[model samples]
Target: MMLPETLREIIIKSGFIKQEDFDGAVKSARELGKNLTDILIYRGLISEDVLGQLVAEYYKVPYISLSKKVITVDLLRLIPEEAATTFRILPFSKTEDTVSLAMENPLDLEAREFVKRKTGMKIDIYYVTAPDFTAALGQYKKNIQDAFTKIIEENVEKSIGKSGDAVTLGADIPVIKILDTILEYAVAERASDIHFEIMEDSYLIRFRIDGVLRDILSLPIAIHPAIVARIKILSLLKIDEHRIPQDGRFKFKIKENYIALRVSILPGFYGENIVLRILPESTRPLALEELGLIGHNLNFVKQNIRKPHGMILVTGPTGSGKTTTLYSILNILNTTEVKICTVEDPVEYGIKRVNQIQINPAAGLTFAAGLRSLLRHDPDIIMVGEIRDKETAEMAIHSSLTGHLVLSTLHTNDAASTIPRFLDMGAEGFLVASTINLVIAQRLVRKLCTSCIETYKPSEEQLSYLKNFLEDSELTHNFYRGKGCAECGNKGYKGRVGIYEVLEINESMRDLIIKRVSAEDIYKEAVAHGMIPLLRDGMDKALGGITTIEEVLRVVRE
Candidate 1:
C-alpha cells in the first residue's frame, strides 16, 4: 500500500479518530462531492498541524509554519483560486519546476495529481495547521495592503497637513483589524517596539527586534496622518495636537491573548514618530541563571541580593532591560514570609502576593514620595523604579540604612559610575558608602540565532581588539556570526541577552565611597577586586559562540 493509505490505516487504528468517523467522512465526501480528507478536517475530525506533521514524517517532505512566514501575492498567483479552494491548498513558494504547497491534507493524492497536471510542474507538499490554512487561503485570495492603502488615499485631503482627520474613515478597511494585524504580527515576530515614522515621501512601518530596527513595509505619505489618528484614538491620546509629544497606552487582544502596550508619540520634522512598547503582562520572569550572568558575576548577585539590609543597584542606559533584571530577582526572592513593595515610574510586571505601587507624578506620587510612603508599610524589601534625582537617591539609601534591602535602577555607564552618579545627585558620600552593597552595570546584546549562525575566522583588526579585552593567549576559540535565515526574519538574531559587570562592595570600597573617590580610581579598585566588566562578558559570549565579535563591539566598544 502507498504511504497515504498506510497512514490512513494507521490513523484509523491509532484511535484519534474512530472507524465511524472515517466512514462518516467518506460517506459525506461522496454525497458532498468533497475530498475525504477535507470532509474529515471540516467536520473537526483531525488537527491540521498534527496531520501535517504525520504526513511530513511519513513522506519525508518539509513541514511549513505559516505563522511567522511571509506570503507574497506572486507566490499565491501560481495556483489558481478554484484549484486551491477545492484542494484546501495554499501556494507557499515556487521555483522553476518545483512548487511548494502548504496543504490542509498533504496526503491527498487526487489533489496532488491535479496540481502537477494543471501547473505542468513538480509538486511539493507542506503541512499547515487548520486555522493557519484557512487564514492563508483567505489572505492569498486578496491583497491586505489594498485594505488600508485605499482608506488613506480616499481620505488624503482630510489627513494631510493635519494631526488627525476630524472625520474617521471606517470604510473598506476596518481600523480595528488593520491595527490588530500590526500588533499580532509584531508579537509573533518577537518585536520589542513597533515604530511608525513619517518620511518625506512615504510612511514607514518597522519593528525593533532583538535590539535592531527592521523595515516591515512602506506606504505613501498621504496615508500616514490617518493611521496616526487611528493609533492616537486607540491609545486615547489627543489626536489634534501635532506640535507636542504625547504619551499614552492601550491594551489589545488577539483571540484569547491580551497584551498591554505603552504608546509614545514624538513630533517629527515631517510628521509624528510613534513607538509602541509591549509591557510584560501574563508573562513569567526569567530565572536568575537565565539572565546570562555567568561565573563570578552571577555568584556576586546571588550572594549580595540575599543580604538582609543593604542596597543593590542595576545601572544602564535607557531600554537596557534594567527593569527586567530587577523583576527577575524579585520573582526569585518572592516568598510568603517576606513583604515586598515597589515604587516604579511605570510598573511593567506584576508578581503574585507582592505589593506593587506605580509612581504617577501627576498624582503627587513621585519616586521619592512613593518610597517614603512605602517605608511606612513595614516591608522588608523595597524597590524604587529609578534614582533620577538626588532626593530619590538619598531616600533609596536611607531606606537601606534603616535595615531594609533596597533595589533600584539608574542611568549610568558602568558599575564604578553608579556611586559617582548618586553623589552627583547630592547624595552624602558616607551614606552612600554605608548603604551600598553591590552595583551591576549591563547592556543588552542580540543573541545569534542557532538555526543559521555561521562560523568565520577573525580579521587582524578583530584579533587585536580581542587580545585587549580577553586574556586568551592563543585566541583559538571559534567565532560565529549570524548568516540570516527565514526563522529569524533574515536578521541573524532571534533574541537578546545581557552583558553584565558586577561590582561587589567590600570595606575598602566603602572607604573609597566615603572619601568621595573619583570614578576612574573607583573603577581601578573594582578591577583590582576582580570585578568583570561588560566588555569581558561580551567577549566571553563571543568566544562561546553565543554571539559574534562584531555584535559584541557594537554595544560595548561604543
Candidate 2:
C-alpha cells in the first residue's frame, strides 16, 4: 500500500511495529494473516484510515494529510458538497501554472496540499474566519445556506417541538442550557427530588415538588444516556461500572449559593435509575419550643439536657428529622468549657467547638469500637452515631451512667417504641431507665405554600377525624388547605416543618419502666402527665396554616 514512504518510515521508527514481525507473521499464518493489513490488524497497530493512506501511497495516488495540510477549494470538493457549503468554501481559480483559491480556512495545510496535487498547479492560499469566509463565498453561499437549512429541518423533526425556542443542528445540541433551565425551575418550585427517566423515544424530566411528582420537560431519547452519565459523573458515582448499585454525594455552587446533593443509583431493567435528594445549604433548626412542647415541658427537657449526666435518646423512623433535633439540642448545650465529641456514620454538618468522628466500617472504625475508645478521651458530652447493635447501645448507656452526658439516635417509630428498640438490642429495662434522660420523636410534614394557601371550612367527616385524633370534644372553625398557584409551582406547598413527640424520663416514668410497664401503658401515663403526642404538633401546624389538613392527615394518621 502506498502510504507516504516518509510516514511509513516515521511509524516504523516510532517503535509501534517491527517489519520482521509483520512479514514473518503474515507469511506463517495462512488464514489469520493473509495480508499485511491483516497482520497490522492482528497487531492492532494501525487504524483503517492509516491502512487506506498506505495503500494510496503504494499506488502513487495523491495523498492529503489531514493533520498537516491546509484546506483549499479542491480538498473542500472531496467533502460532501453539503458539508463544504455549510462551512463556506468556494470560488476556485486556475491560471496557466497556478491556482489561486478563495476559501474558508485556507491555512488548513491538508486542504492546500490536496488541492495543489490534484490541480497540478502551484497554489496560493488565503485564510478567513467564518463570517468573512461566508461573505466572500458570494453566490455559492446558497449552497451553505441550503445545507444548514436541511440540518435545521432534520433537527426540528427529531426534537418534535419539545424545545421550540432552542435550535439543534444534527447530533450536536446545546444541552447545558436545557439542564440549567430545569434546575432553575426545580429550585423555584422547592423540589426535593429531580427525576430524569429514560424512555424509548424521549427522555422525561420530573420534579418531586411539594411531595408530589410533576413532569417538567422531555427531550429526544438520543440524549438520555449522555445526560444520565453526566449526572452520575457529577455526583462522583461510578460512570463506567453500571452493573451494581452505587451511592454518591456532590455539591453544586449556583449564583454564589451552594446546594448539597445526595445521589442514589440502582440498576433497573432498562438502565440505571437515579434519585437526587437536594439539600439546601441553609435550613432552620427545630428548637425544643418549636417542637410543640409546652414551656414547662421544655423547661423539664432543658433541665435534663443541662444536667451534665445521663444519655439522651432521639428515636424515630428514617427521614424523621432526628438528626436536626439532636443537633439543635447539642447547639444549645455546646459551650467553650464543655468538651463535646461525636461519632457519626456520615457527618452531615460540622459544628464548631465539637470534635466529630466519622464512622467507617470499611476502615475498621465502627460505632461500637469508636464508642469504646471515645470513653478514654474523657469528653464532657459524647454522641454515638446510632445504636445498631447491643455493644454500642451498652457502651453509650455505660458512658452516660458513668458521668458523661451522651446523646444518640435509634431506629424506632415513636418515643414509646424506643424502649422496645433498646430492649431488642439486649438492653436491660432498669439500665435503660437509669441511663436515658429523654427521648424525642419527630416527623416532617410539608408546609402549606404561603403564596397559595386558602382557608376552608372542614367537612363533618374531616372535623370528626380531627377531634378524635386531638382527643378534644370541641371542633374549631379555623382550618386550611393549599390552593394551587404558580409561585408554589402549582403544588400548593413550599417547604417542610417538623412535628415532634417528646418523652421525658421523670421519677414516675422511671419507676414504671422498672416495673416493666407495657409501652402502651407507659405512653398513656405520659399523656396523662401532659406529654403531647406527635399528632397534636402536626395539628397545631395545620390550624396555623403552616401546613395543610391533608398533610397532617397524611403524616399523623394511624
Cα lDDT listed for each candidate = 0.78, 0.66
Against the true structure, what is every candidate's RMSD? 13.3, 28.0
| Clash total of candidate 2 | 17
Model 1 lDDT per residue over 156-274, tens place: 54434543243363221444455667787677667889999898888888988888888977766766666777788878888788899998888887556678999999999998999
Clashing pairs in 1: none
TM-score against native, each model: 0.72, 0.64
Best by TM-score: 1
- List candidate 1 stretches off by more than 4 Å: 1-167, 170-172, 472-474
TM-score of 1: 0.72
TM-score of 2: 0.64
